[model samples]
Target: MPLWLMILLGTIFGGLIFFAIFMFVRSRKKSKEALGASAGETSKYAGQAPPEPEVLAGQVAAIREHDAAFDEGRFLKWAEETFFKVQESWTERQASGARALMTDACFADHERRIGELLAKNEKNELDALAVSGTAIMGIESDKQTDTITVRFNAQCADYTVNAETGEVVRGNKAVGAWVEDWVFMRARPDYLAGGGEMPAGGLETNWRLARIDEVMG
Candidate 1:
């Protein structure tokens, strides 16, 4: 390879590696930083109220038309459970355990993250991880799918450890709280009823997380 070409290739490869590490660190324990909490702060949002569900009134009504069983209270309960379930899987690096609870794209992203951690011989530790509150912050629907954005108030002491040496490579072990938005989606019956293409499954498909987004304080 030409010298300049080699240098360019090396730079690109190095950038990708850095990006992967950056994303992994952000996902694992940067919630406080993302939420603008200082190092001495505990859980900044521990006493915070979840967004009012009233904002999603219209979206809930629309979703109920497709599946009358849709209930805000019930869904919030399930979402809170899901927050714990997914966090357990993430900390354990067992993407398979969360496959059914996430959309294909979401699953793929998590699976790849797990693979990368394994390759690097690192693990994210989430001790005392807990969700204090969960609520439907917003919802939207189309002929294809009904999507809900859930806001979660959670706290955890997250750190990355070396798998073999068991040394904490990053993050403080202090428990900190942060708020985040998790988006879940379910296929609409009409989309399947029409036999048209969709991002995921058809009739009787359960709600699955499509994505997770950081909520800035």
Candidate 2:
């Protein structure tokens, strides 16, 4: 080959090598910059604090309503709907929806024991008295946990019986007291009354509604 041709070929080969090296260096710098940016982002997130969970405003309102209901002597209604509803569901064998209101040991064996007693006393008229007029002495609220403990001064009345067989059972007006604790959880009154297996989970409304009413008397 001629010297000119050799020189021209050599120049072309050198230019190709230089171009490859330049591209490789540029790519490596770009990769390193991207890695550094990613690291900075990750470190920032790791060092930063997380946001707190927000409590609903409606929960506060519900809490107030619960207190008002109790003060107004509507607890019997609440118990009939909430407590009795749970008991009813458990007896009906659809216990999934209603949270086990009573402890396992409290009424495990005597599921329908209360109901049986009440049924026997069906003929006797029962008058539910107000907490203020009867035995409810005082109530105190726990701010931290949002719980209320109502102290009672139990006042109960007895039924009357005929004197045909020397059975004169007069109404007994005795002040007896009982206390119950309530929490807000998914409660299905319909499910407890008749609806079968409650859905897997119940709603937690953050507040309980209380209702009171007289039955027999």
| Winning model by TM-score | 1
**TM-score, one value per model:** 0.73, 0.24
| Candidate 2 local lDDT, 73-107, one digit each (tens) | 45434533544454344333343334344323223
lDDT value, candidate 1, whole model: 0.71
Error of 2 at 130 (Å): 18
Candidate 1 contains a number of clashing pairs equal to 0
lDDT of 1 at 121: 90
Question: Which candidate should be chosen as best, given lDDT against the real structure?
Answer: 1
Question: What overall lDDT goes with each candidate model?
Answer: 0.71, 0.33
